[model samples]
Target: MQISFEEFVTARGPALLRFAYLLCGDRYLAEDVLQEVLARAYRRWSRIGGAPEPYLRKAVLNQYLSWWRRKSSSEALVATVPDRVQAYRTADELAARDEIWTLLATLPRPQRAVLVLRYYLDLSDSEIAELLGYAVPTVRVYAFRALGRLRAALSGRAPTTEARSG
Candidate 1:
């Protein structure tokens, strides 16, 4: 069966935006990428076949990766500590999450993407590899390297040379 583009977006847009945000770690960039992907998808909406979600998601990933490639060197890093606000989570939990996000922002795009895809999205390595157009081994390698970096950072140690290489 087929669905209108508007109906699909109404149902899936928020989740797609969240996925893009996790992939890129920037809200504005994520929105831009999603908008661009949706616009292109709309142009050929009629032609899209069964389960457009996967195709649209992959498009967002590809767009973010390509944009990262083009702008990686020129991107600026800014560190700011957000004001503490009382919420459901404890202060320590919030601080830890902030620290982890900081570390995640430091990772290379592909490594960050792998980590987000594996953990946040809870996709298996094979599924991640297929989505990323990478071999399963490569996906594993990225996850390993990313996790190693996060572990080392959390433990206040430098990553090993092997982890630093790729």
Candidate 2:
């Protein structure tokens, strides 16, 4: 059975927002992009062919990428120190996460997306390929290259090779 918009949003909205935040690395922009995609999905609710979640996700990804492309030329780097949090996480965990987040931001958009999809979303190569409109091999390549970059970043080395576009 097809899911209603309200039901779908109620169940998946938080997860979608988290995904968006991971994608954009900005909570406010993530919310805005998710809202924009949700509005568009609502407008086309009747025509959307299968389960709406996938469509909504694709919409979110497309919207984020569109915004990134538009703003990339003018993007500037600003160093902001994260505030200390009184939470369950140890200082090491927080630092590692922060470091990874910073490294992720330095990656190219596609590589960052690939890493997010594979690690954060726990999707397989085939699934990511389908979601990102890439061939399976291309998806693997992206993942491989992204992981290499991340490893290099963590190890304080520059990426050894440039990522090949598939």
Candidate 3:
């Protein structure tokens, strides 16, 4: 199944953006990665053939992770945050979600990526493994360990597994 680049972007743009945003903590970085991925995907769309999602996802994740690796967090840097940010749901939900993200950021980078892909993006172990180029069992282990850390972090808070299920 051959798809024109425009058609592919029109179809998968939103989902890819959402995935990108969830993968990277910042909207700016997410959008940047999305653009970079799409540009590369467009160049290789013919070779990608049908089912470009996995390829696009892998490319996006790889690009994002690479950027994270090259960054010097404490080194001199200048970037402006938006003056007006879009509001997340309600105040409480927003606060809870922010807390969860903060806890997530505390985990090791690989653990955090695995958990975000597994739970927030709702990718299965196999899917995450494919995207991350890891073994299925490795994905499962990272996700499990990440979940354990999150549980420990939020045990006293309002985000127990029971609440998550309900």
lDDT of the candidates, in the order given: 0.87, 0.82, 0.75
Model 3 weakest 10-residue run by lDDT: 157-166
Measured against the true structure, the TM-scores of the candidates, in listed sequence, are 0.89, 0.85, 0.76
Cα lDDT tens digits, model 2, 1-166, are: 6778888899999999999999988777789889999998888887996677777887888888788778544545466565657689898988898888888887777777888888888999898888888898987887788788888878878777554332
Q: Which rank order by lDDT, best down to worst?
A: 1, 2, 3
Q: Root-mean-square deviation of each candidate, in angstroms?
A: 2.4, 2.8, 5.6
- Sorted by TM-score, highest first, which candidate order results? 1, 2, 3
Residue 8, model 2, lDDT: 83
lDDT, model 2, position 18: 95
| lDDT: the better of candidates 1 and 3 | 1
Q: What is the lDDT of candidate 3?
A: 0.75
Poorly placed runs, candidate 2 (over 4 Å): 71-84, 162-166
What tens digits encode model 3's per-residue C-alpha lDDT throughout 1-166? 5878898789998888887887776677789889988988877788997888877877878887776788644444233444765675677876797788677666666776787787777888888888788999877777777777678677765444532320
What lDDT score goes with residue 98 in model 1? 81
Q: List candidate 1 segments past 4 Å from native.
A: 72-86
